[model samples]
Target: IGGGSTHAWCQVYLPGAGWVEFDPTNGIIGNRDLIRVAVARDPNQAIPLSGTYAGSPDDDLGMKVQVNVICEAVAGDSMGASAS
Candidate 1:
């Protein structure tokens, strides 16, 4: 909500804990139901085919996204969020 991109996530490293990811935007405390494409030391690091906008200070930009999550039917599985 501050600038550039709309979402962000980070991981932390503890001595014996290795690396753990946390997504503050979705209140997700772990890497469950997520994918790790690439890791960066700095959030500003450039991603392949990624770009930035150069616009007037007063100009506004916007985007909209829709997400639909479906769970696969696994044997003896009935523990998760159900879409309604």
Candidate 2:
């Protein structure tokens, strides 16, 4: 895994490669840290986060969310080396 800011990206299916990921926001190809959270033919179908809260207007304090990705070295593998 790698560390980067949260951004939206999409994937395309290639003939021999199958599904490949692309990050238009960062101009990245074959993203290393991107995780597939949802799959949909339309962008509106795949939502990163959504929810509803029921409470008094005055009681609502809003919400705070943070996401972090941590990468761990596999057994017998060098931390600085890339996996094939």
Candidate 3:
């Protein structure tokens, strides 16, 4: 997630509609770009420090999330283009 962000948002429960999810970041109705790597009962249960850690949890650790999409095609490259 290079320029992307990681957040924990709650889902609203409607009486007749059941559970509905709304993304406040993009202002969309459903989960389109949302990447669900892990799932839990609540956000509190989710957010456990992952990624690279040196020595121990108390020691210096580095975490990185990269979200890169090949937006354009290169002249000689064959990777292809990506869409948003």
User: What lDDT score goes with residue 57 in model 1?
Assistant: 86
User: Would you list the C-alpha lDDT of every candidate in the order shown?
Assistant: 0.65, 0.69, 0.62
Q: What is the per-residue lDDT of model 3 for residues 1-84, given as tens digits with 9 covering 90 to 100?
A: 221567654568879988877767666455666765557896666875546445865764445766565467669886765666
Q: lDDT tens digits, residues 1-84, model 1?
A: 432345568887867988888777666776875554456877666353456889998897766544566658787877684877
Q: Name every residue pair that clashes in candidate 1.
A: none
> Lowest-scoring 10 consecutive residues by lDDT in candidate 3?
1-10
* Per-residue alpha-carbon lDDT of candidate 2 for residues 13-80, written as tens digits (9 for 90 to 100): 98999988987776678967566656788776887756677888778454454657667888997878
- Winner by TM-score: 2
Cα TM-score of candidate 1: 0.40
Task: Tell me how candidate 3 scores on lDDT.
Answer: 0.62
Candidate order, lDDT descending? 2, 1, 3
